[model samples]
Target: MFRRRPARELSADDLLTTLGRLTAQARAGAELQRARVELAEALQREMLPAALPGVPGVRAAAAYAPARNGLDIGGDWYDGFPLPGGRLAFCIGDVQGHDVEAAAFMGQIRMGLRAVAGGGADPGVVLARANELLLSVDSPLFATCTFLTFDPVAWEVVAARAGHPPGVWATADGRCGIAEENGGAPLGVLPGETYPVTYWRLAPRGAFALLTDGVVEGPSFPIEAGLAEAAKRVRDRAPTGDPADVAAAVMDVAEFTGHTDDAAVVVLCYDRADRDNG
Candidate 1:
């Protein structure tokens, strides 16, 4: 018959065995966590557009980088698609938090925005309607977004922001600056928020960049400094390459790995020759 031993009387072998079991359990837990992150990343990528739409007289491209550490998945997302009336719409947004819930919420928001924008409303009106839709949902997540509607025929763009980072615009002459316009509160925050639309003329041989906060706001950098750096990078690279190349170049210069948050960017370039000739 076996007798129960006192807690203090555990043998060295018993302690070693317990430690081994715990080590194995820890490794298994880590592996499971890694697998979850991978799955989340794949799901989030599905939410993003596989390729930017090919708009006449314009070149569009987008890039997304997941977080290097932590869950490797975030709410950052970018999308570009054709709208009615020969106009194109591009958007970038960031949902709160960096988990599966946030990713799911982001997907819903993107779909909602796309549906609302497709109805031919102005950028500001589309955002307002989107805000109302989000408020009607049961989600607790709030999101920041910047939406732009480009009219190739008029060579102009209208932009609206919901507490998101200002867009970067560069002219062919190398002049670059942030699109500082009046913006309303983030979606899901206040009901019936009115987002103001800012009108901008698209420069021939120029590019506009839209990015989530992860690209500009980091622990070591303030938003203003980061915005300046982004504008400078775009101005330096805007002289060459298409929108995709410019987007990649900007992402490289931004040093995304330095921060733990994911980054999403979209660049839209307009060529006067294409507009006039094509």
Candidate 2:
């Protein structure tokens, strides 16, 4: 038989000691969660480019916002680099999580993108290689992405999508529309997945831009409506020929719509003529 211990009135010093121990434990737990978030945020900042490179006849800019919610950071990323023979490449993607593990894989996918794209592979092939690379890692996480290569001389862009949201295109004449992206399974979902390519040309003074899903979707907000609103914002702002403004215009959607996800966007506004903004 177990005997119930009698409850004794606690001395003031004993109560104070018990309270301090509980307080310390609670503080330690909170600090631990904050530390994880800080580390992931640092990793994200380190992975992103210090500055977007300049492309002939195109002014480019990108923006990133972390939900930084909960105990981890999310996996929204974008990249740009100049290719051989006056071509430029850019992409945006979201891996399937909000944890340090997601950010680590995000870095891996990014490196693969840079390496394969640096070889000047076709945009479709670039994503295919990336798919292979991700599968090789054998991580449970999958990612959605849009990859595109542009030639200013020809005013052409070849893009491929891996279950990502279609990008926005704004013509110089003040028309804005979403790209009807040829979709494939998200990376790491299928081995040897071939992402079909889509082609579009942005005439001088037009704009090509990609945004992660976070910009458009949130609780009580339909993604369709968010996308339509983004199109309107781009149309109203793209003609200004300022890539920064265009990026801001898109990011504004996330802010006003109360999205709870991390967001990223890349805006490349084709200039009427090439100028050095590098």
Clash counts per candidate, in order, are 0, 0
Top TM-score model:
1
lDDT of 1 by residue, 138-234 (tens): 6889999999899988889999999999988787798999999999999988998999999987778788899877777777778788788888878
Candidate with maximal lDDT: 2
lDDT string for model 2 (60-122, tens) is 899888783566588999988888888888989999988778888889988899899988798
lDDT of 1: 0.85
Instruction: Give lDDT: candidate 1, residue 187.
Output: 90
Off by over 4 Å in 1: 1-7
